[model samples]
Target: MTTANNANNNLSPWQPGQSGNPSGRPKGTRDLIGYVLETTDGGKELIDALLFIVRGVTPNVVVQKGTRPRKGQQVRPADQLKAIEMLLDRGFGRSPQQLDIAHNVSSRPLEHLSDEMLKLLVESARQLKEGIGGGYW
Candidate 1:
């Protein structure tokens, strides 16, 4: 029986300007993984593991409590390449990709074109649609 306005009003307890969480996530609050990496030995271990992978060596890191230790296996060339890429990306940010885009299409407003130009444009479009002339489209 509640109207749309009443439904919206009940959705939020705070007033318009008031924030639901006034003191948004404590300034130094970090996620578990980030905290472990920053404060504990995990960060160094992670870098070491990445280096080991790059070098085709199986790192002696425990996965589960009861599982048998992993035997040294030849790391795939693709995997080693990926590890190298990850390390480079983390150490010195990912390389910027260069994109070459060539735009040849005209985007002039219809009103800006002369009557004769507009007619020619329409004829060209009609020809293109009918498979008469060579066009990119």
Candidate 2:
């Protein structure tokens, strides 16, 4: 179709990691986190969960009026994930049975699912974002 051709023509010069302008962020500086899932369903679920937390509550965002945005709290995703896992382990005895039991019935033990997990859940709500395609930012 002519429309498809026009789209391709518009995109022809813009290859991945290519800039028409020579100056940019430079190589290896940009950190892009992409998820590889075993199944589409698994991928979707992960994406959904991430989206949910991001949209619902962004703990890092400090509401300020008429001022430039402040630097966000610096924490690597891997570190955050590890902290969450550790907290879950500490709170609910690192076992499938424990997790299942906690989920099936509310208990004081499950209250300790780590602040990080709660933050992630709030920041990334399970809904597609506008313009950025799918998943939470």
Candidate 3:
């Protein structure tokens, strides 16, 4: 059985919003993962390999078909998923996710809503976000 590890919170005396060392690592600073990757021997090679796989340059990686399964073909779940995604993305195209009200309004005629109505909608949305509204979702 593994023992539970306790954090030494009392080690740093600094309170909230106060730092012991102010001139620490600046904002937008990346961690050692990137640095390690850059310094390591097979890092570039690994990246190139990953890119090659993603780009579908390597012959025997995943599904060969861009569309969904037909006839009596041996189906790999991962490949099948990719095929479905590829088919939809390339053919019908992926639709943008809307907040509650889905579908493109541009295609359908929209009535000009009043300022009060707009405000109410915004307030309702805010309430939904804050979990104040009766969340059906």
- The local distance difference test score of each candidate is 0.79, 0.50, 0.57
Best by lDDT: 1
What is the model-wide C-alpha lDDT for candidate 3? 0.57
TM-score of each: 0.50, 0.19, 0.23
Q: What is the lDDT of candidate 2?
A: 0.50
Candidate 3's residue-wise lDDT over 1-137, tens digit each? 23333355336577999977798886546656667567655365544434443454442333355653344444455654565565567558885544576766467443576778778868987887886774543
Model 2 lDDT per residue over 4-95, tens place:
89888776566897768878666644432232454336456544444433344223322375553345544456645755665567558875
Stretch of 10 with least lDDT, candidate 1: 96-105
Q: Which pairs of residues collide in model 1?
A: none
Tell me the spans in candidate 2 whose CA falls farther than 4 Å from its real position. 1-73, 96-137
Write the residue-wise lDDT of candidate 1 on 100-127 in tens digits.
5485446666798899999998999888
**Comparing 1 and 2 on TM-score, the stronger one:** 1
Model 2 alpha-carbon miss at residue 3, Å: 83
Segments in model 1 whose C-alpha atoms lie over 4 Å from true places: 1-31, 38-42, 105-137
In terms of lDDT, the poorest run of 10 residues in model 3 is 1-10
